[model samples]
Target: MIQTLKLHSLKWLCIALYLPFSLAAATLVGTPRGWRNIDWLDVFGEGGGALMVLAWTLLILGSRPAGTVSNLIFAGLGLIFVSLWQDNIDEFWIIPDAQLWDTWLENVPMPIGVVILTLGLIRWYQEQRILMAQLSKRERFRREHRSVDPVTRLASADYLEQQLDVELRAARRDQAPVSLLLLDVDGFDRINRRHGVAEGDRLLQALTDLLLLNLRDGDLMCRYGGDRFAIMLPHTNETMAVIMAGELTAAVSHFAYHTHYEGERVRLTASVGLALALSDSPRALMQRADHALADAKQKGAGSHASAA
Candidate 1:
């Protein structure tokens, strides 16, 4: 968590420096308003707003990775917080009429902040759309965290079967084709024996990321079991599924995974099986994919087979 926060140090450092300077400016050039002249209502309201804005800025920086959307949102929130802080301070400090800095501080940032915030939100909407597309597969399983595998963060076998049933029904109703691909890491047990289980787990996680990057937006990838993954491709036919399976096989073969401990390059390969939905049951589809996967494994590493 500390390391993650450090990734957003730019925003935090800015806030830290800005706060002291704003306070020092308020103290140096302005006289403290007497208790009788101070507006308590403005102090409470503007002070609360500034606090809330600061909270929001911290929340955004903490939750999101450092990227374009995060940077924009952080900047906008920072500016808004600064403006509100100045406004709140103005209630307690009486600046000379000749001094325009206080007015500039209170007025300049708010509208600029709002414009930047609007642009950030628009980009955020687009980003969410892509993520939702990627997540649509897992969403079919009711979003149970327990159903997610700890290693790959993909749906577990039981959850995959449940979602397969849902997709099977949808396919039957719409008369659309659905395909399943089963991929198993070749020589994974050898990797574990040679490099340790921790390294093996790292390999699985890295392979999961690679597969996800290669899959289509709507495809659902799941951890069927150890060293085995299943993918559900809705509205895809046998030929397209076979092609995708081959692509996955090639991708895994090309991936150069390195051991975390030794930094030794671990070359990898995978066998893939593709089966189109013929029956309206998840069991039938999975069984065929499994059979095809077994055939691919028998053929050799980096091989793929489609169910007849």
Candidate 2:
């Protein structure tokens, strides 16, 4: 948290400067109220409110990375804190009637702070909705956090099956087609042997990124254990699925990977098999794609095949 706060040091510096400046201005230009004249109740209320706002500002800065949302939120909160701090100072000092700036300080920031804060919250909500939509494609209804692959950063095979069942049901009801594609890296074990296992993991991560680039927004990809991946395509027929499979295989074959340790170039290739859903259970669909993948493997590396 301390390191994260350091990233936004400039914002924090602004708060630090404003705090002392507010205090000093009130003390220098305003007459200090005697102890009997001070309203302790207002002091407690206003000062406590300022402290609370300060704590909130620190939490927001420490938790979020420096960005538009962070900046807007910090700016808004900083303004609110300033307004409250000035209000609290009023309990100890009485500004001369001639000085209108103190009145401006007390009145200006509260409403403007609220408006800016509302805008920041709206933007933050929109961001969360987009993230949830993307996550839905990968995990579907059973959004178990553990159902994500640690190495590839894709959904796990179990998550793929769960989403496949949902898609299959929806396809059957709407009379729309769905497709499943199973892809496996060709001779992945040999790559792991030639290059270190760490390098092999990096290769898989890179390939995952490549495959994602070739897929549509609605397509779901998952890591089906080591060197194997599964994709679920909703509202797609066998023809489109086969074309997508070929594109993925071609992309993998053309990808150039270098070993992190030895700095040696590594050539990568993938084989893909596709099956269209037609009154088929999720297990049957998967089995068909798996068989098709075996057939593709027999054809040679970087080959794509489709099931009848």
**Tens-digit lDDT string for candidate 2 (214-247):** 8888888899889999999999987788889988
At residue 233, give the lDDT of candidate 2. Answer: 92
Off-target runs (Cα >4 Å) in candidate 1 are 7-10, 29-44, 63-71, 94-99, 125-166, 209-217, 238-308
C-alpha lDDT (0 to 100) for residue 164 of candidate 1? 83
Tell me the deviation in Å of residue 27 in model 1.
2.9
Tens-place lDDT per residue, model 1, 63-131, is 788899998898788888889999998898888867798888889999999999989999999998788
- The 0-to-1 C-alpha lDDT of every candidate, in the order given, reads 0.87, 0.87
User: For every candidate structure, what is the RMSD over all alpha carbons to the true structure, in angstroms?
Assistant: 4.6, 4.4
- The regions of model 2 sitting more than 4 angstroms off are 1-4, 20-67, 85-104, 121-150, 279-284, 298-300, 305-308
Weakest lDDT window of 10 consecutive positions for candidate 1: 133-142
Candidate 2, position 127, lDDT: 82
